[model samples]
Target: MIRRKGCSEKGRRSPIYRVAICEDEAPIREALLQMCRELLSQLAPEHQVEAFASARELAQALADGAPFDLLCLDILMEGQNGMEFAQKLREENERISILFITGSSQYLKDGYSVRPIQYLFKPVQREELEDALRTDLRLHHRPRTLTLRTGNKTTVLPIQDIRYLESQNHWVVVHMREGQQTFRSSLSEVERLLPPDQFCRSHNSYLVNMAWVAQTGRRELLLQDGSQVPVSRGYYESMQRQFVRFLNLK
Candidate 1:
């Protein structure tokens, strides 16, 4: 595994970002792994990088609860090809970023279905690899955990698990798949803490997670949880544009 130090508070350590590389060719896999370690050391700072020789091995690791934020996949392989594995993987996960590396451009059109962040031709250049990695890092730069204080109690919530946030007067309600938590904070204050690309202002009183948005109408948005959030006339156009951009980027 590859590891590096990250920027953090005096008493807190940076959250670990997990990355995986799967390539059947040993020489190519080793070269890619080293490049990732070197690039991520400066780009992400704190991360865990793992390499796999086959798609099955990586899939098994995922089945055993391994978490990866980014995947570097080689197109042609011995048995199950990278494109097939990525298509299957997308059925279950829609957020993870994929970067495809191949020697031939024959399968370029097929790769678009899975919506990879970028594609690289083999004999990969360090500059091109760095560009793909930079895009992935920017998309996932939000803090993993959010600290909330209510009365005398303080709680930490995983940012990705949040579905949407509702503002009620002086208190904000944090909605999640598990339940809800009401905290004494302004919606604007919480919005400042979240990444702008991932979350958007649906209305003056509501902030919606773009990933949870299933449908959007002229006046409202339908979340994955089946709840509807209002979209004011002023924010509707911009919200739709941002949501479309988010979908394309994903």
Candidate 2:
């Protein structure tokens, strides 16, 4: 899953971030990464950052399970451009904030559809870069816990340990590494409780944890546990996108 791993940006305090820079030009790419490091050093002391020559490389790393809180993407390249790539990213997970870097103003109107946190133009000014990092978002990581109640007993489980959840008549069954647990609740209710960036509605009967998903097809999702879950026609593309966001995949 990893080609080469740099320093792990484990947040030493609250409001830590994971950031990436995807640019085709080496000079521009290094400049952006340097700016990020300088700003993050002041704003988020423990942020993890990475640089990529193309969008494809960044997408591959995400697929391999590297967590990125923010992605700094470029708009033009030899292959998949940043605007189209960002659109694809939106379909998966919607939590990672994006910052687009480009030399052209033509894509501005079109790029806004993906809702980037900010935009930095070519020859980016240090003041603007500083403002974007400092005054904008002070994003925080979500806690890895799932709280469920089944009658008189209540359970607070680690999110990483759970695989998926299935909804029956009036209850939801949680399938996890240990086994299964059931609680009287609707799938919607459970979905609301879980982090949107990590879970998705695979079908009307199922809510899946994106981390455990192995493979996906037009009609079903394969989980690490070797179980197949149906993917409703309405949610097919969206489900794939959600998995992409979850895995940070291509």
Candidate 3:
């Protein structure tokens, strides 16, 4: 499933994405595994891909606490089909991205029931499969963690959990879903470390996460947490544009 997790350690930057492939045919299964491994090596070098010859095997792995960021499943199999397995998996884990590889177009309607990312026909083309994998990566990828230095203690915060950043004189306050953490750093310095596309400079002293923003106006932004952040005139237009672009991506 879409394995999203918070920062667990210090100084670790790259996050590994785990992918799985399920196809009964030995040749097709091997081919799919190779394609996925090759593409992920270029896109995300720290990724992993596991191949299963049947849906039951994949299900057993999941039951054994195996985590997967994406699943490349073939629709038809020996006992349990891909669509049936996907439906069962979705009940427990809805975050995982599924890419269906089917032999016929008849399963197209049923595939949508589980909300798959894309469907590729039999004898899948490398280009089409690559495109589907790219989409899955985009949906699964998240911004890196932000290391905050607070006095003698250091705090590592996942960028995705941060709702906003506020500048209070020489100190910066990191507002997150859990709580707030104050650190000695300038707003500009913190801005430089954050991803430009995810964090927007709403005001001279405030940087807001577009993902947490619910509504935007000329002067203020309403966040999902019901907090209002001021939007400076200089950054209002840019904030609006960025928010729109972020929405389109979602």
Candidate 4:
């Protein structure tokens, strides 16, 4: 969803700006994709812009491990419409930016609930597109920081840097790319601080980041870093479902 661009690209953590344009009409879809390609080309040296004639195609691409930074959706389509797809994305992941393309202003009010960056009415304007693209770039490049206070020291860690969190008694250790930081906090308290779409509890003692989770076995969750996190019997189903959803997001 709101992945920090090239997370799994190149060697490791190489971020790329990716955009997905979903529109049923072929002409519009191609045109929109071209516009995005042209825009991103001017903005970044390396970028990918893809177009799908239907929402289903785009959804399938995402389900198949495609990384996308922003989604451009058309409200009306053949089967599953843009609104429906947007709602589904919200349920699965919350960080990806969404911009709706509709022919009328009537959908503007309805689109507010999805927290979209903006809407492009019929005959998309150059200025409007540029503004929305700029917003998208800012969100994708922004660093996600999380602050923790333990004893007399306070540590700030980027949310993406953290692979998972493990709690023991009243303290939780933040497992990150570099190393671990201990903080005086409960697992539930730490969970509350993170965005629900990105992290989930795999056990009473473990809070896992969906982004870095590589695989899930019968007894444990395997992270991309080759670390194993315990998964309790009661939390197994939830963790499995979360993992499936996480895969779908990529």
Better of 2 and 3 by TM-score: 3
Scored by TM-score, the top model is 3
Assess each prediction's global lDDT (C-alpha) against the native: 0.82, 0.75, 0.81, 0.77
Backbone clashes under 3 angstroms, per model: 0, 4, 0, 5
Residue 205 C-alpha lDDT in model 2? 87
Q: Is candidate 1 or candidate 4 better by TM-score?
A: 1
In model 1, the runs with Cα more than 4 Å from the true position are 1-14, 144-250
TM-score (C-alpha, index-matched) for candidate 3 = 0.57
| lDDT for each residue of candidate 4 in 1-250, tens digit (9 for 90 to 100) | 0123234432232346678999888888877888887876655435788889888899999889787778999998889989989999889876678999999776778788889998898678766786688666655633366766656676677888899999888888889998898877788776755645568889889998888988887689888889898888999998887678556544
Q: Which structure is stronger by TM-score: 1 or 3? A: 3
Estimate, for each residue in 45-153, the C-alpha lDDT of model 2 and write its tens digit.
4467799998889899988977787788889887999999899999986766788888899899998889988888988888788656543332344445665655667
lDDT of 1 at 19: 84
Clashing pairs in 1: none
Give me the candidate number with maximum lDDT: 1
lDDT of predicted model 1:
0.82
Q: In model 2, how large is the Cα lDDT of residue 164? A: 89
Model 1 error, position 149 (Å): 11
Candidate 2 versus truth, CA RMSD in Å, comes to 15.3
**What would the per-residue lDDT of candidate 1 be over residues 1-250, giving only the tens digit for each residue?**
1112222323233456678999999999999999999987755556789999999999999889777878899999988989999999999987677999999999999999999999999999998997787677666544667777666677878777899999999889989878998887789878766655678888999999899999999898998889899999999998987788678668
